[model samples]
Target chain A: MDFTPQELLIASITRMLRGLNHVAVGASSPIPGAAALAARRLSDGHLRVSVLGSRKNNFFTDGGRELFDCAAQGRIDAFFLGGGQIDGQANINLVGTGGYPRTDVRWPGSFGSAYLYFLVPRVILFREEHTPRVFVPKVDFISAPGVSEPNVYRPGGPYALLTGKALFAFDKARQRFRLETVHPGFSVADVEASTGFEFDRTAHVDVTPAPEPELLALLRGPVRDEVAETYPQFAATVMCGSDDKENRV
Target chain B: MAEHGPIVSLDALAAQVPDGALLAVPPDYSGVAMEATRALIRRGVKRLHLVAVPTSGLQAELLIGAGCVETIEAAAITLGEAGPAPRFSAAVKSGAVHIRDATCPAIHAAFQAAEKGIPFMPLRGIIGTDMLRYRTDWRTIQNPLAEGDDPIVLLPAIQPDIALFHVPLADREGNVWIGRRRELVTMAHAAKRTLVTAETIQEQSLLEDERLAAGVIPALYVSAIAEAERGAWPIGLEGRYEPDAAHIADYVRTARSEDGFRAYLAQHVLAGRRAA
Candidate 1:
């Protein structure tokens, strides 16, 4: 069965999330939501995932009171985050560009990357595209840490690195990142070609599998509907990918 | 030059901050605050305090990592960090600094207590939980005419020594226009000194929008103002940039491991301080 790039991306995220007991998804992130839904439906509800966004689930939400109360109470086991730029060590930067006074680009990233990255034991870094622009040799700034370099420990660092082209698992032993697997359509060469810097590829990389039919159904159904009502921009983006019609196989 | 407090450079502002001073920080504005913390830490100030709503992002991590004076969880879940760091968790539980989870009403009660120059305010909720145990400074009083009933706890007023906010714009006299977000207002009214760091220093009259004008942090409350560009890099302002993954990764690698944490401080923060 052939799957589009977006489908494959969602499937890979689901696979990663399924391995965890619980997960946290950010706001307006279709990949995170779709993946969580896919994991629950495909894994037979074995996965317990929680969604956290700027807006509280209910109106009576306290301002900074229950913040991370879920995680503190051990409700979440894993988390998914996105970034504008990711570096070799897996640090993420959604902030400003190089040259401080005037940045080259700016983005509206979720505010809690530092807290989430620091607090969550396993944080999966997901991005829509894999390019030199997004996957840079070094980020202009450091929003969260991927790997602690000499003297950098403030708190909340990234755990895993996920990209559109390939999947990465950080190796603390070597102090450099290693290739875990590549997306189904992408080859080692394809990933290497996309990235500007040379990555360690000593081991053979596996190809991520497609989402199960049941998983895709969950994503296209309740999850999609819920997210659409919550975030219209994300709904519009996901809807553009494929027809909402259910697939009959 | 003006009737209000002086405008200082980033270095001067960093130097002026005293050691062990309680700093009230916005829950989500970590990117901007970290740079300031780094500057202050470089100048050898310890025992910082943070006031924030728990959201998963850069600001929350810095507060935990830097070891704040008291971290009041203003939100539902501490959403900032993806997972928990054992050291930070231990710190919260052990009460080196206080970590309280409460509602907006409780927060407002505490701030109102500070504004009114009171020691603490009695609240009905948060009666029988771990929140009571850790907040020992908060007193408990008997309910009038109620027998065999547990007493309600009183949350102490949070009058911070300084309220430091990083926003989009400010005037030379430290008249801050927070744009649409009013998260800093409570700190402004509750703190003894208010310091602001802005992305740009525009004229005072640039605040023309009626809605924005209503949220201004007046010069009377603000003691110092400085211009810090890309101030919220790792932390984010709604319309501004995102976090720096590389830097964050470096911080994680260095801080998560004990040896890595020491090495990181030695090289980046400590060494940089020596150089400066």
Candidate 2:
């Protein structure tokens, strides 16, 4: 029962998106794209997945504005966002590090993460790098805050943060992250050592569930092929589909 | 009238843009005007207010590296999956360029305000965050009409001096078919001038055909047009092709240092100065 890191992350994310009607995966997200496909497949296509920047997966015939419009109308139930640095407060920084305007390390500016984070009900904060540098005490700049003021009209915010080591669910009431599960082969201490932000944890932590053989087959087979249309290089290398390079769109 | 049918060379189009212009460009992975960016570098255009319509990638990084940009106002400027934008990152780190960071909706709302000739637009979110703190232009005010404790953020309009992009077609009438990339239309509507590069000059007017008419950015808004096939090179265009992955990867690798970036400009931009 050996699964790649990508498969594990995919499984974790799919479980987070249990009954969401429509899940939207943004550009540069191959892992989430695969997970969305898996969720849709398992739900008998009852779940709708819109993979932005994908020619085949996207059904927006109107244009680029449709994605935002759909989210605003509450049609999009789930979305994914990542950051260069994520903190305990659920503040994520896609912008540069160090300070505002001037920074020692610069990342991309926030795209639709801020807007969609407010609109999408289940905003999953995901990042593959699970170290202190990424999981910071405080993010340098907040691209999208995990919780908004009481008056702000927001239907969505951070639900859970999935990383290489563990999964932490955001408690909006407490404005903190609680350790949900540590991935297989990783310990609570390992997560504690790597995570810069403090989080409440159960005395007995559960290992992340492994994907069943059926799910595994779907991931390696149809799901990988679907993701390759948008992220050819990622699908090629990450999903162990190096042989399927020619099949990429 | 002079601009209505001006299908000039890429050089001519780039030359129209002078120093210290607030230029609005599209995001990465959609209608990125890369050829024009390269030309702007070759022209040594200086002190540009580079507005990344919502977000950006190679185009912003290339300009920042060339030292042609003085300010960048955008959401982010990474090379997407290719990783960090080396030049943009280095410039910000060194305090070489002014960075005005805002969220995606703020940028879009600004454009929307400009499109409608409004002073500002109200948007949700940014409260209880650093985004509102760093942005002096953003203001939070009590909702005069609301019942209780309701405050909202308002963003001033972003009216750029120029809007530039590449597309699949622009007919003789200057009507450019943008397909589903509606942000370009908003950018064109918001900017004072718009420059477009195209893969093909259509034989029939885009407006004449109902199927294509829905996607056309009316020639009324297009001030200049250039026939630059693969104009969005290294960047992808919807329905046309995938981003030049090898080229994007090369840009990430070569743009890591000042010298490497200069070498890239020499090979791709300055050396190919045969545009005008």
Candidate 3:
């Protein structure tokens, strides 16, 4: 069965979230949102997914601070972080490139990554465009570092990085990413040319497995419909096919 | 009537905000008083040291573009799905506005410190980021309680002169129902004065109801209230209505240029188009 790139990404990310208890996705992260929902479906509703900006998905009642407060207490199991620039050390810069206060190119300043990155254990670094501009040797600014010193009370850091090109698992001890699986249709050479940082790759890097028919059915059915509530545009353009008259199918 | 008493007109609510006051406003989803924002612009309230608790969206952009703000401290400011906020970016790049870049929890923790009437609060993360370098007000010290070195960042309390936001309802007693958005309560608690714009002011007392009492900021915290139906227009109030995406898209397009932004202001904001 043919699938869109978004479907591929969603499936890949869901696999990363296999045993996680609770996954929280932030704003403008439809792909992660869908993945978290897909993970929940796979877990038979065991996995709790909180997608910010969605009333149904999020269970926080105290307020916006609840998510951070909960994470500080180590309630959130997995979360996603993206950056305009991500370095080899797994340092991510959500803030723009250049000097402070007056960056030449400003994306958005780091929201909660500065806090959540340290608190949430499984921080999945995500960004679709995997070019050198994004995957830099050194980020102009470090919104959150991938590693902290021994004394820092950090229970969390980067777990793995999923990009359009491939998936790289962060080797925390080594402070470098190890090439896990290159996405289908992309070669190891293709990933190498695109990536700015060097990573440890096995002699034989396997292609990422295609989405199982069961997972695809689940994604195309309930997950697609559910994610559409918060991310209509992404669902419409990426998840839903022109031929998908019956979404439940 | 006292400045803090009863429901006032939107203009009157705006008038209470003195020039150059440190104003605390919640993020877009929390409850943004867009109508009151327009009222402030109409009143030409200037030099507001706007604090976007955690983050912000169109409301901050509108305020900055209209020259109502001198400084803006936020973790991040964007138009969400619409992409980067134009005016905020322009203002920052041109040095038109002073930017005190912050992280989300630091901002929240600061407000919490103020709410607790503390001088500062210690936060765990933000140790390695440039946010620490630029934010001189935020200091790093070894954990006083720990025997060994456990450095943490200390954020000074942020007690804004005024806190303003829109909510779904306010009672006759001046208590406003904020539902799950308790950041508004923190904003109310941290600020010296809390001005509110609500969709409706019912005769009923909010605190009297059991279900809503937990969500309601009692009359003591709410200084004044203004009944502006659809107060969070274009941005939309959570649960009440969806954002007018088409209108906001038009704004995103129009506000890309100075001339176009002014035209948008004249037609949409300054044209006596109060939130109806």
Candidate 4:
């Protein structure tokens, strides 16, 4: 099946969330949300998916704090985080470029990352635009450190970093990202050229497998409809050929 | 005696909020009092210390652009799918507003501490990040009970002067039904005073209904109530209406620059108030 880049990304994310009991996707995250939904579908309703900002998917009854509370109690197995800049050590900067307070450029401030990056065991760092600017030598600011001191009460940290170009697994013990696979049409040199930070690569980097026909159908049909409920623009524009204006949320 | 009396006009409700007040507001998806926000803008309220329970959107941006906010304590401020909140970004870049950067849980935990009448609340994480350095008010302490060298961050309680939000219903007796969005309850509890604007003033007391009693924030916390129909306009109230995406898109476009933002304020906010 001819799959879109978004579908491929979704499939990659879905595979990563294989064993997680409950996966939570935060606000303004369409790809992660779709992938979580797909993971639930593949898990035969075993994997619980909660997408914030969605009336149907979210199960938190105690308002906004419930998600954090749940994560702190180890209820949430996996969560997704994105950054304005991500460094070699998996330090994600959601704040902005330049110094504290007065930044050269300002992205959205860190939301739950400071807390969630500590509690939730598996945090998939997803950023579509894999450029030197995004994957930096060191982030201008660390909104949430990828690793913490031994004394810090942190059970969660970076597990993997997935970008448009390649997939890299975070070696938390070593405090670095190791290249696991390069996506189709992208070479090891391409990943190295685009990335600003240094990373360890496997002797032979594997090609990220394409989405299966069945998975593509699932993504296009059910996942698209479900994701459209939360992110209508993403669903309409990027989730294959769906131009249902009425479904625009 | 009732904690609050009869419903006031939207402008009157806005008047209750003093300039430089520490005002707490909800996130966009939650119940946001957009009409009340416009009223605050119209009144030319200044130096507001905005506490966005966790995060905020158009409302905070609008206030910042209007030069109402002096400081904003929030987890994040973005326009959701519409992209970055332009005015907020501009203000931060120019150092127009003092930002007390906080994580989502820390904000909630601080509010929870305020609600519980505690001086501070200890939270895990935020140990090595720059947030620790910038947020001087937040402190780190070793766990006294633990045997190991366990370190945790402690956030001081944030007690806002006023907590304001829009809801689906507010009873004549001032009991506001917030449904599942219980963050409003926390906001009301954490603030010194609570101002509420509702879509309708229901005839019966909300607590009378056993089903709704759980979701209702009793009149004791609510200082005043105002009836403003379709109050969460453009942002929309849950189960009531969808967000006016086109209008928001128009706002995103118009709020890109100072001149355009002023034009928006004139046409949509100041002028619309008269018609409203």
Across B1-276, the per-residue lDDT of candidate 2 in tens digits comes to 244456888888999898999999888756888888888888899999998878888888888898999999987777777888898888998889998887777888889999999999887667766777888899999877889888888999999999999998998878899887888989999999999999888778889889988988998999989888878888888778678888889988998889998888889888874442
**Scored by Cα lDDT, where does model 1 land?**
0.59
TM-score of predicted model 4?
Answer: 0.97
Candidate 4 has which clashing residue pairs, if any? none
Candidate 4, residue A152: lDDT: 80
- The digit string of per-residue lDDT tens for model 2 on A146-209 reads 8887778888898999998999999999999999999988999999999998999989999989
Q: Candidate 3: which stretches are off by over 4 Å?
A: A242-249, B1-4
**How does each model score on lDDT?**
0.59, 0.85, 0.90, 0.90
- What does the lDDT read for residue B36 in candidate 4? 89
Model 4 Cα lDDT, one tens digit per residue, A1-249: 456677778889999999879999997899999999988988999999999999888888898999999999999999999999999999999999987799999988999998899999999999999999999999999899998877788889899999999999999888999999998889999999999999998789999989877677788789889999899888877885444334222
Off by over 4 Å in 2: A61-65, A241-249, B1-4, B273-276
DockQ of each: 0.03, 0.64, 0.78, 0.86
lDDT of 3 by residue, B1-276 (tens): 345457888889899999999999998888899999988998999999999998999999999999989999999999887888888888888889999988888999999999999999998988888788888899999999999889999999999999999999998789999999989999999999999999889998887889999999998888889988888989878999988877888888999998989999999789975537
Better of 1 and 2 by lDDT: 2
lDDT by residue (tens digit), candidate 3, A8-86: 8888999999988999999889999999998999999999999988988988998788899999899999999999999
Give the number of the best model, judged by DockQ.
4
Q: Which stretches of candidate 4 lie over 4 Å from their true place?
A: A242-249, B1-4, B274-276
* Candidate 2 DockQ, CA atoms: 0.64
